[model samples]
Target: MTKTNNIEKAYDFGASEFNRKMKRITQERLKRGLPVSLDIPNDATPEELEELKAFDAWTRDGQPVED
Candidate 1:
């Protein structure tokens, strides 16, 4: 029997890809400074896109901290 299943491989691939894309976005945003526009990819899943938008909004809001 194989050690890794297709589903596991697919999930890992998706997660790694998401992280890689996020890293690229982070670098670009850092260069351009905060309050950056939504830079999500066209092929991003709906959930990913939503998360990106929410994160962008949070950053634009100055990422408030709870005291």
Candidate 2:
């Protein structure tokens, strides 16, 4: 449907823009000797990706983590 297509397009555009900003921020941080927030490698495995997702879910978007 047209609505689904538009939503997918919006998601793709947002994801692309986010990646662009992250890459720019990462580059600037590297130039300034600052630590980057994300550090997943190009060859990351499924387990690594899942771990990252779980970690993000627990720590991001106002999600509370138990001590």
Tens digits of lDDT, candidate 2, 1-67: 0123345211221144554455455556666888657567889997666555544333233322222
Please give, for residues 1-67, the per-residue lDDT of candidate 1 as tens digits.
Answer: 1113442211222245555455455556766875445567879996676566555543343332222
Off by over 4 Å in 1: 1-35, 63-67
Candidate 1 global CA lDDT score: 0.48
List TM-scores for all candidates, in order. Answer: 0.38, 0.37
What overall lDDT goes with each candidate model?
0.48, 0.46
Q: Clashes in model 2: which pairs?
A: none
